[model samples]
Target: MDPMYQELKEIEHRPYPLQPSPWLMTQVWRDLLFMHYPVSTDIIKSYIPTELELDIFENKAWISMIPLRITNMRARGIPPVPYMNSYLELNVRTYVVYQGIPGIYFFSLDANHPLVVTGARTVTGLPYKHANMSFEKHEETFHYASQRIHTAKKLNVAYQPGHILFEPQEGSIDHWLLERYCMYSFRGGQILRGDIHHDKWKVNRAEAVISTNTLVPFIPGEFIGKPPLLHYSRRRRFFIYPLKEV
Candidate 1:
């Protein structure tokens, strides 16, 4: 087999041993900024469902606030929908595992489009909220901002990619945070799992200055003061499967 094909196969099969049988939707995430902070395990545990086991790294739990642009979103075998396809999204999430399958559990997901938010809530049963968001590129830096409609949660930051595009090394903290394939959500006292397929992340060293951040109110005040580990990616295509009751 070709070397590249072998590498791709390994990424697909390893970590999580299964793939979603029939993918339900397709989308592209662009200009993503991943900002992660270490938080106390007890604080994170308190906010998540009891059914999920907190996934810790180096004896610590981490939460990420990711801001990205979504484009080319469409259902299977269909073209992108008009007026509902593209938008900005920011999510506060943590890692969790159920029955040995590791996945992401979101605390909150805010998007600019109401139809997209409603559709996601109805289909995936995840916590999706409406927000006003904007994105602009100036010379080198990307300016991003989001404000939730119902809450005081908001974020404003400026970031840009450094000069290199590198992949995370295996068995590293960056690898642990970026290389997850599945996600778990709670709905009506039940747990639902969804698997996402995408190419290996091509990450760039990122620099960000956060002007304002109140995205995760549940996190303790002290932990919020520490600077986050930052990384950026220009784009990635995603294949998202329907949520299956676990």
Candidate 2:
């Protein structure tokens, strides 16, 4: 079987069955860093769209800043282009459940590639902005940075994955944060959802030094000042289906 098909065999961990439609594209997220913070539900309520409700974990709302390199990216029936296929991305997102299905809600997504940024914005309806970013690996530790264009928001983080890796329990916070299979966005005065499928995430304890992170300005600096809950996954291959009205 093809490796992409192999990723679908472990669907028992999925919250719902895969979409009957064929996936539209594939990408691999490498050196991914997930920095999560708990925030007041009241603070997040206003940012959320009226049609959607916040997906709370442990009675508190959560948000995450993820910095990753997207590789092996190409649409169905096309081959991956050498330079265009890979780029760095930093996204600020929170969780939401719409019509009983859990999904991600993005506040912003910054990428280093202009074409990819524009294409994602037009194609997926998700927020994708251009930024200057870089990634450097030193043995087990990695240094990643990004500065968004036309805005003062930026991120600088150094993280390393731990030796032991394991699957997050079904109801654990880790599962709640990483197991989401779809994302919701508002475009053209309507709600849009895109189905996402990937193999089980085998994560390890992660430690990060967030020297500076102003990705979500409305989020108080106090939350940024406090240490965040960290998790790391070296890589994960993702298949994203097309977006459509919910």
Candidate 3:
């Protein structure tokens, strides 16, 4: 087996089944900032579909806001498309489990590209919205900003990666937040899951300042105070599988 595959096989705390047979697409995520906050399980469960169970840690549910650069995206065995090859994406997500398999459930995804946004919504049955977004790096800090089209929702954050890079320890809250291997979507009264494969995440403690954050309205919260946990990753490649009904 290839060394990369060998390393992936050694990933700690992977609870889902391995990626099966052929993959649907591949992509790379870069300059990712993960900001997570704890919420009541009752609040989260009201938003998720009835078919899935909310996955929690110590009786608390969590939501994450991730702003990242997406690149090198393409179908399996195909070259990356011209304009759609790269874009900026910000996602708001929570955790869930279906039939004992843990996965992610996205509340909303905002992207700069219209085609990518439409394609993702159509194919994956997720709520992907078009946004005016920008990403830039100045000195050691990276800046990300996004505004949803035709809506007042907006997010602005500036962050820098810390010096120490390490993997989340097993059974820790960081591990629970970052190590999910599959994602769930609901459409037409059916549950769907898409598997994603990646090597264990190497993350750095992150420092961030939030200038404005109107994205909290999507969840059932009146306000989100300072995030409790923040982490950053330089880059990671992904092997993505097609969505399958559960």
Q: Which candidate is the best by TM-score?
A: 2
39-158, model 1: which lDDT tens digit per residue? 889877999999999999999898999999999888877767898789999989999999998889999899999988998999888899999999999999999999999889999999
lDDT of 3 by residue, 146-165 (tens): 99999998999999989999
Model 2, residue 25: distance off in Å is: 0.6
Q: Indicate the worst ten consecutive residues by lDDT in candidate 1.
A: 1-10
> Root-mean-square deviation of each candidate, in angstroms?
3.5, 1.6, 2.5
lDDT of each: 0.86, 0.88, 0.87
Query: What TM-score against the true fold does each predicted structure earn?
Result: 0.92, 0.95, 0.93
Off by over 4 Å in 3: 1-13, 218-225
Candidate 2 matches the true fold with a TM-score of 0.95
lDDT of 2 by residue, 1-246 (tens): 234568877798888999999888999999888888888899888998989999998898999989999999987778888899999999899999999999999999999999999988988888899999999999888999899998888999888888899999888999999999999999888999999999988999888777888888565566675446788898898999989898
